[model samples]
Target: MRKSKSFSARTLDANALKSFAHPLRLRIYELLDERGPATATGLAALLGENTGATSYHLRELARHGMIEVAAGMGRGKEKYWRVVPGGFTYGDAPPDAEAASALEVLLDDLVRQRGSELARWREGASRAPAEWVEASGFGRRSLRLTVEETAELRDQVLEVLERYRTVADGRQAEAAEEGRDPSTGHVVIHFDVLPLGAVPEDEAAGQEADPAGQEAGPA
Candidate 1:
């Protein structure tokens, strides 16, 4: 299993990857992760989709072990579904050609969605709560490190995030038991680490020519 800050997820095999590569299925999974448990009807309304379609996709997701029935939500004939605790991942590489192509499409869609969310947030950030505006924003850094060092840095960051995740889970449970809203905002955390390829010789020479460094571009 591959472990991230918030959860542990097993890498997906070819069959499971193929099953989960649909756009609607991906959106459904994202909703469950972000909004917590919900019924097919609820999800349908949120997505502007018909209940029948949502129900079918939900079942397919569940069949692939992507989601399951929420424990105590919904009544007879209405079932609530949720993302399975500890999600699944697309492994670094899929051996099957078809699966690899599917993974590419899935990843492209995910990146597009994330870009949209960030763009939306930026457009409305000024009107959001002052505290939220102050606390939320993007961050990035470029570092020179060996492969082992990169792995260590990732593990350390995950450890710190895991601690806060535990606290957040406890607080959520307490709020549920008390039958009161937590008044907590849902926050999304995005983390990524990747190698920047070696600079081209011409670019390297250009950089050396300007010792003062070029201004960074917008993120």
Candidate 2:
């Protein structure tokens, strides 16, 4: 049976990235997923786009099963949109070259956004001194858990992050809620976990003894 939760949310895992591949669909999914429920007009307003355009994109998303109509948000006449409850996953869906391309497109948009900001900073616009500036990423070698444990850990972190997904410090309050590019600026959390190749002989040299009390090495 599926896990139950409020927010009428769908718990997604490996299928999320695939469903989120389309550009407009991804944006619409994010909007509906994050902001609760919205209408086509509301989505367009939040995205600075035409309502018709938003509606067309939403139809496409629905057709592809990336989103679904949320309950209790609409009356008889008005229409509403929302992400399917727990309606996403990460890697469960079938492999799609289109989805991979869509991911590349999303990554490019992120890079372009960062580049735009860097350009602004380089223009000598001494905005309030950088509050935080650091980039750190490293590969690690460690394996002490099964696949189930790894999934649990990832889910736990995601749940915690969702709690603060809309947190703000007063500046551009709406930006935080609506997920727009902040007029001042905003922070990003780029967390990733990927599998690496098997451990090498050099690194294995540092491990402590195994259960048999012998130096840790390939059994």
Candidate 3:
């Protein structure tokens, strides 16, 4: 499996999210998210769909700039597709409407992806590198920190995740070289950096400081 590029959740534009509303589209994006690039035929096998079906979905994704043909992978008929890496920073639809439903689909894809990644990790656990195997786990804890401090902690967590994320793909080949892992099963280690706050549920609810002061609290 290819290493996934970690995204800091961003507002996904309605157009972008809508483009991905199709089940096949979500599957294609998720496949690329976990397995890196592949041709239509290869993706079909992985998705249990016909090559034409996969090809059409991939083309749709390519049209939306969700996936791009990897450069220099090979010559003819070996196009590769990849997910665009960034937090969703474009969706402006209301939370309880049609577009919101679309956004939910995208979010569901993300949650499903975490499940797929976990399953793949377990299946390959024994065949993976000791360091990779050792570096894996699901962790959680309550934390006490000011809002800004919590934001800082989140950024720090993302930074560390970025540093380790390079190990999966060669985007940061130098970092990959520094963290030597014995060659073994191809893996993208999942690290859930969930920082649960210790604040009261009501206080946490009041922590809604949307950029525009619209105050959209967590429901």
Candidate 4:
């Protein structure tokens, strides 16, 4: 059985990327996922968009399975919207040209979002609680490992994050049952795992030997 308190994710294929590449749809999904649920009107106000535009995008997102009809009614008894239980994962580079284009759009949006978040934190962190300021950080480290070892390390890191989320979700549920608000505001964590240095010696030699469109290239 799937873990109730932890998140689940689906890997997006080429076709799925087509429907999820829109800017408004991406923003709507993020808002719904982060902040429980909201009506199109409410989302429009929060996003500074018109209600009609928000409603249209919401419908599109629902059609793509990114959002669903949330419980409770809104103004005019219209349905509220919330994100699906799990999120999506896609590779930076997909084989299909269309999918790659969509991934590019998403990555560009993510870059802007990350910059905005960092700016907000930098401007406000000093005045915030000492504990929070101390806990928040950014760092980089270099590690040398074989491909299999690298994959193992990545899995371990993901497992650790899932465990923490599970614990937090359980506590939130308990707080809700006790009739107390459990929210402590939103916190976003970003992880980057990328190769930064030169290619492996064997691969480099292979490429040098065949500098044409013949032999298979290093992935």
Candidate 5:
């Protein structure tokens, strides 16, 4: 949320995609994004990995510009790393077979991670504060829309999120200058929008026959 002039949006090329596709590297990036700057030793402890491995992956991520040394945060001879401020996307499908495989791995891992996070939240929700428990949950809706309409809806949602991000940044800066509140805590927001139930005919044919003997098609 802390926008800086140094931050720039990135679309991962094949090389960068391959570099970032490793499970450990992806997890390390997530940790940095969620928990702020950390040292290799600290990350290793959390990840149950050796410092050597974490250090190597950290360097790899840095090489791809996914992360950087957190300024003024580490003592001499030690370094802290954090995710770069701007976000990144996978971009178009990679032509290289290896890179394409890496992209699949990355996407699968991300979907699994999201499910795990939601499950964790549900398990702990009962023990959380009453207000938070009341305020937090998931919602889903099936909507009919054209491609352009779907894109417009996605953009509007992103704009709203950006507004909140700016507000959060301002509050964080104020807290840093003054004093932090004990009641403040981190919140993770997830947003996803995509066409549903659109399967290729060949893929659908390969699936088991429906009970009603109907062909599978778009919902």
Candidate 6:
């Protein structure tokens, strides 16, 4: 397990990012980061992939230092892997066409995964504990701001998250040392600020206009 800290992050080189851009590899990394240590067989079972295939990818991840052997788990032919403690940040998309393509693939996979997780959560909401059912939520709001203000807001949010992270890490460390489990609940936060430029009146009208051949019909 990773040691407790305020927050840690690293930027991946283009090659490292490219290596991590694979769909299965991304999923594997997510699993390790979220669920802690697990053997290749364990991950394979969860992902519905063959153990051999998973093992191969795990080795690839290890080569890139995205994951490492869980030393607490006894060493043998079987190996348990855990994510390196930190987050990944990319200042800008890679300039290389191939790297850019890989980035697109990774982003698409992430969007799909987020949708899947939400669907799974919704389906199981009724069965979830009362506290979780009541606590979990979703919301959206549109804000008008200059680019400078937007950047400042993002930095503020990151600062707040890092503060809370320090507390969480301390608690986790204490629990592990005491030979007890930490919180079982996991929180997923999705944050984004998309700027949709002004649309022309003609374009707006065209979008609202029905197709010439289509007749209006309603229930």
- In the range 103-172, model 6's lDDT, one tens digit per residue, is 7767666677678778888899999989888989987778888888876776677777667666655644
Which candidate achieves the best lDDT against the true structure?
5
Candidate 3 per-residue lDDT over residues 88-151, each given as its tens digit: 3433455646678877766556666777777777787899768876877766667676877766
RMSD of each: 6.4, 12.4, 8.7, 7.4, 6.1, 6.6
* Per-residue alpha-carbon lDDT of candidate 4 for residues 15-39, written as tens digits (9 for 90 to 100): 7687788877888887876776688
Q: What is the C-alpha lDDT of each candidate?
A: 0.76, 0.54, 0.63, 0.71, 0.77, 0.72
The candidate 2 region of ten consecutive residues with least summed lDDT is: 1-10
lDDT of 2: 0.54
Per-model TM values vs. the true structure: 0.78, 0.44, 0.64, 0.74, 0.80, 0.78
What is residue 82's positional error in candidate 5, in angstroms?
1.1
Alpha carbon deviation, residue 160, candidate 3 (Å): 2.8
Off by over 4 Å in 5: 1-8, 166-183, 201-219
Clash count for each candidate, listed in order shown: 0, 17, 10, 0, 0, 0
lDDT string, candidate 5, 1-219, tens digits: 212222333678899989998889989999987776789999999999999999999999999999998766668989989777546777666899999998887877767777878988989998999988887879888998888888777777767776776666565545435644567666777778857556677667655455467543311
Q: Using alpha carbons, what is the TM-score of model 3?
A: 0.64
| CA lDDT, candidate 6, residue 120 | 82
Which 10 consecutive residues of model 5 have the lowest summed lDDT?
A: 1-10
Model 3 misplacement above 4 A: 1-11, 84-96, 163-219
Tens digit per residue, CA lDDT, model 2, 58-128: 87767656666754456785677655433333332235666655555555554554455456555644544
Candidate achieving the largest TM-score: 5
